[model samples]
Target: MKKFTSIKLAIAAACLAASSAQADTILGLYAGAQYWQVEPEGQFGSSDDQQAAFNYDDDAQGSFYVALEHPVPLIPNIKIRQTQLEVAGSQNMSFNFNGTAFDGKVSTEADLSNTDLTLYYEVLDNGLASLDFGVTVKSLDGEIMVMDDDGTSEMQELTGYVPMGYLAAQVGLPLTGLSLYGDVSVLSIGDHSLTDYQAGIAYAFVDNIAVDISAQLGYRSFKLELDDLDGIHSDLEFSGAYAGLEVHF
Candidate 1:
């Protein structure tokens, strides 16, 4: 079993390397990575009517994406992007969370960590501009543990998947190595609403026939509001600045 698995992995790696070693052309590949310094705010509760004031120190988030483009007509190019979200803080409550009642004087730490996976396609690509559209599935797979100074504790598990609309666009600046780009993934369905957006500028540093490398700086914001889904209800917002690197293969 181990030998078979290793053989499969080696084959996959060889194929990826062979494709990436070629020069950029009608069929090209690319990958990107970025990190953000996020500031989070707002409150969360077990029920919609019960919320606690929430605050946290600055947190860091990381994102990555890889894409494949081919000359096939009517078939969209595919890209996959993933991002990590994590935060921890202590706040006094306005009501109850995880069945622990508080009169606005109890101090407890809360951790809400999540990840978003986006699978999108290139709707339009050209020399002047490009656009992509698809769907993103946000996996809210984390937990919140609350405890007072007396060691009294409670745990509320947060786990769910939300499908959202994804769209992105990029515009090149004439007579320069700079470009502007923006991305959004949002939706309002049933009792939940989620929105994530980012806008940034990119500067190509090394562009040649074989490879291209670029630097990027941007700002991003995300909001998640839930209403009694999986016994969790809250409004959370994260906004911050980011820096990134992009490579064409």
Candidate 2:
């Protein structure tokens, strides 16, 4: 009788342990690369010495990000997702005077980069559809260089904080271990605002390794403050493509 009671108690304890493991939360980590481009629009300058036209070009910018997500018990089939990104790049700008390029180097190079941190609640699981709504805090730090016709130059560095809110949604469909997804985000920084949209597809070959290809379209309009140059301001617009990989554990 004593042996039977001990055996029953051990079985009950094992079942309880298994149930606890099933209720434990799981976390996911994602890291990837991004390509970015920038183009400016709108007018710059006040009355005298004012110009309405400008030209600019961007090669390809690189960026990266990490995200964390977990399920919410109050809302069935819903989770919360948060992410942060670091981006950097350079661009060339030129000013045109009545179809003649200015003898002076009106062009500038910018080492503009920023980090974005966001928190949002996501709904829909089962790998079919998901929606996220949240707010983002941005920290920007960079320098812009302006050159003169005689090849002389000066540098201006800017560092500040900005806040913005965003919403993102994604839908997935599977075909031969591959899935397609789409996302969009809108941000407001000072007097400037931007809307970014992207669509992509990923292939999962083994379980922990995956390859993704995505294209991005963006629209932006912002005002900037500059020193040493009177009546200085800017309006920018850009779009591009990106491809990267993800590892899950």
Candidate 3:
């Protein structure tokens, strides 16, 4: 089994190298990585009316994405992004999580890592401006745990899929190697809603025939409000500034 997995990885690496070599001719490949310094705020609970506040410290998170675009007639481009969202803190108040009640001081940990898969069509792509319209499906596999002073604990697992609308736009400044870009994904269904947005400026420090590299500085905000999805209910927000690098070929 190990040898078979190694062979599959080798084949995949070879195909990726070949694709990178010819990406400029028939494919537009983009890859980016970012470091975000975010602060978490809000409350979480198993039921909407019964909740516990989160007192978390600020943390730095990492994210990365890869996208492939082609000129095929009605097919949309695809992009995949992975993000890390985990926080730990202590809560001093008494609360009930699920059916277990906790008193006095307790340690809390929550992990809400997610992945976004987007399929978008370029509505316009000129030298000066670009726009894309798409749909995104975000999957979350997360959990929250709280431990009391007596070593007793309760954990609630959260897993769900959310469908959202995606929109991205970019505009370039003539005679300058700078551009402004932003994207947003939003969904609202009944008592639940999610909104994630980012706006940034990019400087194309290295532009060539083979590849273009850019440095980015931006701010991002994510708001999640849940109403009993996967036996969890919460309202959380993560917002902060980020720095990143992007490469296109």
Candidate 4:
């Protein structure tokens, strides 16, 4: 999704306050990256009854995030995340896209992804429990392209941004160095509904005040339902397991 913006002053104030009162509380900086092997299945066209089939083989997608959290109360913490959604497959499709009909055996590619800049408030963050809620602007800067083996090609550029609601929660097991975490972002309005979420277990190899390293394994699922916006109509789902590394400093 192409993302959303314009509410930076509140977060800027939080950062400023955190900088001024550095030694009184915790100021956490963290980064994480993951690789997901996705299986895609969906349909695309101008309308529901006039769509074409999509069956994609297994493929890998990359996602990463950087976040900053301080002792500030009301103003939200900041997390910047980038995810790539790319998958390709071959099929015999006959459908109408953007009001034009194309019929043939073609190779299709769907690239739907964006960088999410999120501002969230910590609802609860203690030793054993943590929860966060906020909003993000997902910048969709990708496209969908289809080509027949006979040199005929067509592409639909997906370039837009939308605001999504965000939620995250974590619960740690005592003395186990293990935790359960889930994160979600969703937007549903009018004729569009999009959602992405991940739930996983994380084991901390090294947990300390100054630095922490963790290994995480999780399942991620993303679904997109778009209705004739910008000439492309699509219903897509991409999901799979992921292994990731996260570090906090």
Candidate 3 local Cα displacement, residue 249, angstroms: 1.3
Residue-level lDDT of model 1, residues 1-249, one tens digit each, is 999999999999888766654434467888999998999888778877777765577888888888887766667666666777767677655456767765544554444555666666776777789998888887777776666655667777878888889999999998799999999999898878889899999999997657899999999998888887778787988899999999986
Best by TM-score: 3
Of the two candidates 1 and 3, the one with more favorable TM-score, higher being better, is: 3
Candidate 2 CA-lDDT value = 0.49
Clashing pairs in 1: none
> How many residue pairs of model 4 clash at the backbone?
12
Q: What lDDT score is found at residue 245 in candidate 4?
A: 98
lDDT tens string, model 2, 39-135? Answer: 4333332322444333445445555666666565543222222222222222234444223333443655555466667666665555566677776
The residue-level lDDT of candidate 1 at 221 comes to: 91
Evaluate candidate 1 by giving its C-alpha RMSD to the native, one decimal. Answer: 10.6
- Which digits, one per residue and each the tens of the lDDT, describe model 4 over residues 1-249? 123233476677778766644632568888999999898888877666777876688999999999999887787899999998888888786755655556677787778877999999987877699999999888898988877777777788888888999999999999899999999999999889889899999999997545789999999998888987677677888999999999988
Off-target runs (Cα >4 Å) in candidate 1 are 1-26, 102-115
TM-score for each predicted model, relative to the true structure: 0.82, 0.61, 0.89, 0.87
Residue pair clashes in candidate 2: 39-237, 40-236, 41-235
Error of 2 at 126 (Å): 2.4
Question: How accurate locally, in lDDT, is each candidate?
Answer: 0.79, 0.49, 0.91, 0.85
Residue 107 accuracy (lDDT) in model 3: 78
Q: What is the lDDT of residue 196 in candidate 3?
A: 86
